[model samples]
Target: MPFIPHTDEDITGMLDVIGVDSIDALFDEIPKELRAKELAGVPSGLSEMEVTQLLQARARIDGEPTCFIGAGAYDHHIPAAVWQITTRGEFYSAYTPYQAEASQGTLQVLYEFQSMMTALTGLDVSNASLYDGASALAEAVLMAVRANRKVKTTRVLMPRSVHPFYRRTVRSIVQHQGIDLVEVDFDTETGQTTLAHCETAGDEPFAALVVPQPNVFGVLEDVNALTDWAQSRDALVIGVVNPVALALLSPPGDWGQNGADIACGEGQPLGMPLASGGPYLGFLCCQQAFIRQLPGRIAGKTEDVDGKVGYTLTLQAREQHIRRSKATSNICTNQGLLVTAATVHMAILGAEGLERVAAACLANTDRLAQQLCEVPGVEPIFEAPAFHERALRLPAPTEDVLAALAEQDILGGFDLGREYPELGCALLVCATERRTDAEIAAYREALASTLAIAEAA
Candidate 1:
């Protein structure tokens, strides 16, 4: 919609109807000292055309840098139809489906999304969606603690190989709830959290073990072993996974003898663009036995009075619907719009199409790693088999090299030193299906030049 400013008369009429002299009067309840006198350093308003031109100019300045940094969020190709259909009046502006009768369209979309997610993860049930991958893992942790009756301890065996941000989020959310997150270190040689590392936690009973397939380092863990080990000790296994990788690798449901109790991860790779860190979607799925403990809402398909097909929210265990103390979670809503896009994206691609995408990503990253390793003083950090991303040790400092790459409008990759200083000068790089052969070659050339310049200095 084009910008339409209200006329002076329109403003006056609204103020009159509200019995307010001016817009400032609406905030009269706020103390004068607390209220800002003005938006300091703010630019003056511009004409619509001028504003559009200004934004376009700024966008041109940034150009579209080739994105190789996929620590969590990825740069996947989003089909044109995905957003075109999603932004329609019905889907874009749809509100919470408090009244199912009025929201069958939205309810149906949610149902399809849940069905697709379950199929991908090989789990029995999936929530509508969560805030993001990190928050979803936090919710998963809380749920594991609540559902695991065999374990008396609230300790969750968290691997250092898991995304560092996810670990921090779990701590911040569950710390006061008396949940203990015990860190499990990864093997330096393979960049994987081994059974030996998990054993370091000792024989003490813990609620759950977080198993990340193709963990933060992009190294595939021995999930079958990890899952079985956790279950033997009566500990639930929580799989932190990549949805795209799930297409090729075994799903969390097929992890081990009994399978992982819960699985969750960022749904950004499905269709979302890395628009400065999202508006991304988080997916949480689990076994049917843990359905009651699942946070967020679930959409269900059913029949109407006439026996016609219908859709509605089946499980709303959030704080809003149930007693606050009895609620499954304080999360009041789901990411409906983002879910709509993801559902459409999956429907467009289907199973075989998604598999091709996953395969392409793996091939591209492998090629990228091989090419980068050819450069002098650049080497693979781990010997483990990886998926779409890999860790590379650089003779040059990661931050400096990345900065130089950025100067050439190439987002090289993530600097591991910032989070994992022990890895010293290591970088994590990714290559999605969208990354072309030329783009990959360009990145290699840029990095080689950057390192040469650094060494000469």
Candidate 2:
């Protein structure tokens, strides 16, 4: 689509209507330093043919290296059918269906997505979607605050071991809103986020406590224990889970069976590509009691006069559109396109297939870790149970190691120094189903060479 389709006459009409002499006059802010000095040096506008070739060439350039990089968005294998169905003109072009009648198809997909998320989390109610995992967690916090029904609680406990980015995001969203983020410590050796660090009182209490199962470090947490700790107070427990890990470990709902209140997580592993960080779906689900407090949309099934089952947007009262400040949450738009993609992916890979994918990820990560241990200067950080990712403390600084690996076209893992400075020279590694045994061996060989070079230097 032409972003600005202005004909000569249309431009003239607009300028005339605005009483402007030339377009440059509109930006006459009297700041030469800020504005480009003489229209800048560049080629004249290209013809359609030239522009197409230039863009195609740029698109073909491979930016990311040939190996691992998954903090949250994984490098899992996406089936061809995903793209085939997602690219359908009808699904691609559809936007928010304000009119329930006109958007039945979209509504139905959302309904199914909600059902699947609910089933996956083992929660009674699931919202259609939220923005992404971070936003979903922020919404979950707000929901917990509202559920308190007492004086708005000032503090919420988040584990230091949770995704550092997610903790930062939660802080950004709630700081201005007058909420204190209490950082709970984790067992350095075990990599478990324990609730013992939090000091709660009857009057001055936590509104909610957010912890990830198989947290950012990839260690499986004793979620039942965490849940029990939170419930002792009236604090709501929010579990930020990786949907794929549910296959190997217990689901959050089962954690709820012990005592969890709400669940929120990134749904990217279900089939969405990393896509350079997103357009990924954030999934949120809660117990039936908290359904009214959940943010975003909910598609419910209803019957028509003729006795046919039809899906329609239900529970509109919790959103900003209806309740404003008093709304359950301000999340206005659910990631419709990404949510549909996740739904399709889930349908294609049923419960059994999901387990297989999870198994592959687990096995690959184990292999990667095993190979890394063989390298002279590398050591696995913790002796904890991880789902499909882990951290390795190397002999040299992580950046130096990363630079060496880049020479071999291996992307390598995220560096832990920026967040966990205590873990001085650790490289966080992730392995998904997409990584093969041969590729892992190559990574091992490359990493070994890099370590040796760094040591010799």
Candidate 3:
């Protein structure tokens, strides 16, 4: 599409038709104090060719560094065909499927995405998609409070081991609604939340308990015991998990005798890239009983009047589709494009292939940790077994070491002290299937050199 600037007459005529004197009048409802007078930092508009060249130069500045940082977003191998099929005109340009007859292809793709998510979590039902992992968890927290009829309190047990960003997101979203997010501390030794921590909440009831598999520290929690305890107390268990790890570890739905009620997490590992903090997909799933409380839209497969199979949006309890007072959530649309890519990625890598990828990631991370631990003044922080990532204590300042590593074009791991001050000078590192032995060795050498430099300084 070519850019066409509207003339003064065009703007004046449109404003007159709308009974507004000026373009700023359109936003008269906004407080003047809250409005920006001008975009002072924005650069002047550039020609198409000039903008293209500028972007190309910026892209060149961002060299492809070997990434070992898997805090939430992961760096995985995406098949060439995943995006190729996803960006086709039919799927790429498609919008919300308001009319089922005209959107069979897009609706069917969503149906397949939901089916795969349910299978991955071992849950009975799955929503289309949410904003991202953090928002999805916020939605799950709200859903748990509404779905748990037995528990009257809106308090939820959130472990400190859950991603710090996710916890903050959940609190910001639910705090206005009288939701109390009680913090449960993790054991310093294992880096996992223990059953004893929940007991500190006393006999008072909580609506839900959030259990993160292979927590932020990359240590697996004792989910079975935690889930069973929550269920015994009439509290729902919400599992925040990694989709890839699900191929090996027990699914959230099978965590305990009754199983978790809800499972939500980032779906980036499935097929999406870490694209500089995303545009990522968030997946939410639950048992059949709580389907009504599930936010976002769901696609269903059914037979048409001609007895032919068809796909259409179903259980759309969002505010846009129904009465505001009765709606389940205000979340408007699903991440359709990301979902398309994920569905295609899962289809290409079936059960066996996914398991192999998971196994390889576990092996690579373990190997990297072992090799790095051989360096002086660096060792595993926690004794518990980990899945894809691990936390290591460093003798020098984590921020300084990471800065030195970045100078050598190696994207080192996350600095834990920023969020976890108790664990001083800790670094969280990961090694996915996409990582090579050579790359892991390079990271080890880079870290050793950085540490040596820090010690000398």
Candidate with the greatest lDDT versus the true structure: 1
Give candidate 1 misplaced runs (Cα > 4 Å).
1-45
Per-residue lDDT of candidate 2, residues 102-170 (tens digit) = 788889999999889888888788989888898888888877877765446867888888898888888
Candidate structures ordered by lDDT, highest first: 1, 3, 2
In model 3, the Cα lDDT at residue 187 comes to 92
Between candidates 1 and 3, the one scoring higher on TM-score is 1
- Which parts of model 3 are misplaced by more than 4 Å? 1-47
Evaluate model 1: give its TM-score: 0.92
List lDDT for all candidates, in order: 0.92, 0.83, 0.92
lDDT of 1 at 449: 90
Clashes of 2: 0
Candidate 3 — what's its lDDT?
0.92
Sort the predicted structures by TM-score, highest score first. 1, 3, 2
How many collisions between residues are there in candidate 3? Answer: 0
Can you give the TM-score per candidate against the true fold? 0.92, 0.89, 0.91
Clashing pairs in 1: none
Q: Which 10 residues in a row give candidate 3 its minimum summed lDDT?
A: 316-325
